[model samples]
Target: MDAPAERLQAADAELQEIDERIAEIGRQNLDAVADAYKEFSAVLDRYEDRATDRDDFQGYIEFREQMAEVLGSIPDDLPHRDAFTEADDELTTGVTSVLKHANFDRARSQLEPAREYAELRSREQDVQGTYRDARSALQKEQSTLETERNELERLKRLGEADLDAPVSLLREPIEAYNDAVAEAFDSFTHAASARAVLDLVAETTAYPLVEYRPPPENLHEYVHESAVGEESLSRLLDLAGYSSSKLDHYVENPQAFRSNVATNQSYLSGLSATPLQVSWPPVASDALGWHMRERIAVVGRFATDEVVALARAVRDLGLRDDYERLRTSATARESLSETDRTRLRAGEIERDLTTHRASLDSVREILATYPPLGRR
Candidate 1:
């Protein structure tokens, strides 16, 4: 090859080498994070499975003690005991630690933009200070004018590099790794287990509906940052659901609590489909206003402007049959009491026929405008 061509080839190879290095770092970090989540999910599944109704009263500790005994010695087929030991430790604290801090992650996302701007601003200030010092030195010696000029240029480049640090080679790889770790934790920390547990509690307690469980602390802060987050599941639960009173109530009602936890286990294990989450049928029309007044209040909590927005979205999507079904069912059953999960109005009521008729019309009109849905 000609000299110039060979030189170009060498430069290309060097650039390729740098690219490969970055790619390798990306792969390594992604794999590390993925493995952490995989292991966490596995450990959680094992604990939940092992802790049966018999051990329900003992809580999660019973499952952990069982794991300790079984994993005490590495099996002959396994590579090493150290892996098992590490996994045991991870099950005990590592997974929980990651989840406990998961909510803070939302808050941290807001802080990131501020953090980057602050760093850039500080770098700008340093550049200005350096330039001033260089100008002062030039006043002290005419011969140093050229030196100061070069120093200012160097400071300019340094400031550029400092402000552009996030895009720098080293910084890029580090940030990629941080993101991989964050996503890793995010995958498992969604409280799939916790959600299931809460559902089970509701089912086992035989309460057709109850307040939802809360997210881990700080996780809920992402809500209210924007209008969308305001309607998020966590925010809704925090706003309208039962408080920390459930924790105390669990002690007073062990059998019921156990049922709740057990039901959660069942729900998590059952299926991937979203189990009828929202309460429906608009509290059976509440013609008397006093009958199922509590149910009416509960429905009011979930049926909000957000629900209206969602109806608009579905209509926009042109899910023609679905939109019709929702509007029609809500219109038809708008004011009927079937507390036994039936359609016919059955319960005793001082039905104000004229007012009840007006109330039914109101339910139909609101549903047509907002759209309503009920699974059953």
Candidate 2:
């Protein structure tokens, strides 16, 4: 068993032992002991200050009466009957005017049996608390084990890859196509109107992986409605930097351009074709095929025909039978580090995975075996 499971087991055993001891003493008998002692202790506490050393004569009288009543209330058949009698005898000093701390101390010692039974319940409660803490710790460890398993499984999958595969067969074509399209999109953004380029980006919202932040609402509206929409983005950004007097010569409303276009200078400058390009490791063939088909249409709308042809070439590559193997190898090469490769070759990862699974199972078993100690 794991450390958590072992701790749970120890706590469970201690709790069970406490329960058994409580059972042996008989719960009813122990309860009667606790009640009598509660009343017994109460009388001592109340009169300890006032009745001792003749501090108050009436308080001494009241203290003795209450002690006698407490002893009288105990059932004749109650276990350890002598302890109560002894405790009462210790308090009875014939014609004594005042009781002292020594008298109370002697009485308390005689009542040790009652205290023992009363404290048994407290001991049981303490053990139950420990069991509860152990259970919570085991549960947290189980959750951590699940996360570890997932991460290790990913590493194992990478380790199984055929590293000798000519991944460049796939990477070369995809990289070439990616470079061609990136350059083409840059040229498209420089030549096309801002409205045209942004509109094309907006259309890509239907494809999840082709991520582009949707154009700002006010900016989108400005590009679509304003006459300045016809100007290329590169030209507009250069025009936005001009002085208000110079900008007025270029556009009808200089203030309008400042609010709608110049205010969004950061957003406009950040737009790029990076999201349009495929990842180096590439997705599964079917997903890549689907993604490329959608991208082909989107890129074709604004990019050069040569760029469009390169996108088509990437889509064709995804259809090849060797693509999955090469993609897996590429993913392994890109993701795995020297330490990870060493562990994988040494079979240490597999051993670690097995150990985690066993620990998780042990904790689960301990939890199933011993539920919480509820009201008893």
- lDDT of candidate 1 over 88-110, digit per residue (tens): 55445533332222322332343
What residue pairs are clashing in model 1? Answer: 103-219, 196-264, 200-263, 200-264, 201-260
RMSD of 1: 36.5
Give one clash count per candidate, in the order shown: 5, 0
Model 2 ranges with Cα > 4 A deviation: 1-3, 10-133, 243-245, 370-376
Worst 10 residues of 1 by lDDT: 367-376
Single out the weakest 10-residue window by summed lDDT for candidate 2: 367-376
Across residues 13-32, which tens digit of lDDT does each residue of candidate 2 receive? 88778778888999889889
| Model 1, CA-based lDDT | 0.35
- Compute the lDDT for candidate 2: 0.85
